[model samples]
Target: MNLKTIFFTIAFLASFHIFSQNTYVFLGSYNRDKEAESIQVYQLDSEGRLTKVASTTNVINPSYLTISPNGKYIYACTDTKTPNAGSISSFEFNPKNKTLTFLNKQTSGGENPVYISVHKNGKWLVNANYTDGSVAVHPLLENGIIDSMAQNIHYSDRSIHKERQTRSHVHSAVFSPEFDVLFLPDLGADKIRSYAFDENQKKPLTETQIPFTKTDLEAGPRHFTFHPNQKFGYCIEEMSGSISVYTYKNGILQQIQRINTHADEIKEGFESSDIHISPDGKFLYASNRGKENNIAVFSISENGFLKNIGYQSTFGDHPRIFAIDESGKFLVATNVISGNVIVFKRNPITGLLQKTGTEVKMENVSCVQIKKYY
Candidate 1:
């Protein structure tokens, strides 16, 4: 090759390597006593190591977080148990400096706001309140600031579990792949409620005639996620420690299978927390907290059924949430009780995880999110 051509090729490869070397990670913590900051930002190297970049401390009980579709803003649920005291806060994210600037906060319309999801159109923010059993929708301004609650719906129903299901407890609010429907998983009601979402309307969500799908009595649906194909949905049951698979079509969900997240030998105290499917849709993963501090791995069949592959120990306590990187190359688990984050290298071919021996200590970390920063 000519000397000039070889030089240009070397420069192009160097730029690509630099672009692929790091990703931005954001962590939310449940810090009531001010032991640690509420939100933290870090740089995650390709080898799965974390280096602190920036942190903010004003927000309280920032247990969960979701990023905007444009990657310019982050929304977090400020989980407070006092009546009508919960709030959702928005922050502007700067990829250049890895810092977050507080934008604004608004009432969540209920207590103990736990989960937040942004609409694909970047005009709506939906949050689920766990303590007061309600769903709140907020309007997002063009500048990424969140306005007051546009709509709030309360659920009064209760399930069979007397103590835990005394009232409705909405654990998560997730949007469908097409962003035409919203699913709210109620941990205290044993049901997954669906709502039609229309971004064109002033009030974007309305109850459909077929509003919800019921799980087994006292099953306690905690979180819901959709398959990449948009034809299937899965719910992680917090109380039963099982996953319920369903066929989703035009905002309707039909249950297809229910499988245990724990081994048969380990029966009690299995509290499954979060669920995610691989980027390629070849595998599924769920986190178990109570007695079995591990992540269950399942292979996805062509028909959308899940087969149990194996489990990997988290090597920590109370893995409240875990996230797979956008590249599908690494998995990180944030252990709430242990106050440590564990990194696992994922095998793309086998769909299994191996510990990378990279741990970062962050007190009361409850959620971890990874995204590519360009």
Candidate 2:
């Protein structure tokens, strides 16, 4: 090829590569019926548009998903709702083809496994069962198949609420940034239960010196996340519609502040669901589902306190889960009742969100996880 032709060809190839970059989005959902897809995949392009790529109905009610640290495997908390019917399913992600292949599954040792957390080393897989009020641990094989349940711990504690707190309901399993501690937010018990963990141990989880940190009565602590700085932790309360802020260290937590998670003048009956801090650690967001279907945004201080910024309407009902991509440029939220997925452009500096992307419709979309496939 001539030099002029070579330059033009190279420019065209570069443009194609940029246009084809992948932002693989994994969405999990409740089964509306037998034919519903429980887990689906999509590509999020540069313009905040989400285009369907592939989907799978291999598992039922894969409500929550977690990608392995290496990003080679994906695990889902499948079979939610029914008693004794929950399981954790694993899949191998073929990034080259942008597809997922079923690997293996193991009983989560309880029903309604709503959350899964894989160890940073990728050996231990932990999950929390909401219906059965239990926590289970499973070992991961080299090929990403989940082994049998290695340990199971059942919690019988009850909180003040007669209906919602009749028994412990573990809402999420989150590991400390250091991976040395595991925190389980038990919604029904109104506490953040924690454990000291070492993946090499036969039973990796052991209770910490402070087994749990009590929240307000009937607060219903749900999803938990640590600030990127690793100095603070936060959890969204489903019942109280609040975010409890804590200073964390040595697998223990000290409550520093508690702030409302709903929009101004909008209170009561807000069923809060997910909590996530921005990659820059400057912003924190929590989703409310019931009455006020919105996201409460906050600005973070150096001392780990939060100031309410504003709220963004999710424009859908029951936004059960939301995820911020690693770039901190796009935020995706999924609604279960409306069965719609919406992507928002994020302002990294102000921590506000704007609805500018494409909207997608999925059945019972309950969870969203975003990862770049480059």
Candidate 3:
């Protein structure tokens, strides 16, 4: 073939490969069936629709899941809500069939594990047990099996709230952007704990110099998200309906600002669950589960502070967890009580959402994640 013809052929193939890439939506739920369908994988199309393609029943309560850094495996929190029966399960993901094959599991080190986070190197994983108020670490095998629990740390502290903050409840253990630190949010203790992580060590997570950052008196910090600039961290306070902004550096976070997620004054039973930033770093969105069934949108200032800009009603009960497509085109939320998934088209410029009329039923869905696999 001539040079001109060859060049044209190569360009066409590259374009085809880009457009043919598939996007997948993984849902973890508190499903009634422990046999299968508790953790389902769906194919998300360009037109913003979800179609289920595969599922696994090997886990009892895969309420939370984390995709490995290499995107080749999935780790889940199983046996949730069963006292002292919590476990972390592993699976090998087959991209061709869009399925997850069960690998191995290890005790989660506490009861009612709520969240799991895998390191970027894919060599270690950690989980937060909500009921027993502890954290567990496990190393992942090269072949996708989870090794025995490496270390388990239990916290003993109490916050101001007599009802909910009576004891320590570690909600999530999130890795820093560089994967050198782990931030553990303790809901019942009103603190965001920090740890220095070294995956190569026998115990990968160790307490840092500034071990924890205390939140407001009744602010039950549930989840945290970092800005793309890596200088700012946002924590969603569950009971207070607020977001705490911090300046993060070297495994330390200094509080810079605290803003309410709701439009009105803070009240009881707000139950804010999740927080995320847009890919472009211009907007932040947080899900409110109780007292308001909506998403609170904020405009992120250059100084890393947030201003409440708008709100979008989820139109379903208990929007527990939501995922923003990496492409920044869609936002999908799982409403646990209503048993449905809602898809919304995102306006890139305005950082707003509009329902796309592509809702599906997935009873008791709890957590969601979206990714594009080439």
Leading candidate by lDDT: 1
TM value for model 3 = 0.94
The TM-score that candidate 2 achieves is 0.94
Q: Estimate each model's TM-score.
A: 0.95, 0.94, 0.94
lDDT of 3 at 170: 95
Number of the predicted model whose TM-score against the real structure is largest = 1
Q: Write the per-residue lDDT of candidate 2 for residues 63-107, one digit (tens) a residue.
A: 899999888898999878855598899988876787778888889
Estimate the Cα RMSD of every predicted model relative to the unseen true structure. 2.3, 3.3, 2.9
Say what the RMSD of model 3 is: 2.9
Give the C-alpha lDDT of model 1: 0.90
lDDT of candidate model 2 versus the reference:
0.88
Candidate 1 lDDT tens digits, 15-82: 55654454878999888754457899888776777888888876788889999988899899885654
Clashing pairs in 1: none
Lowest-sum lDDT 10-residue window in model 2? 14-23
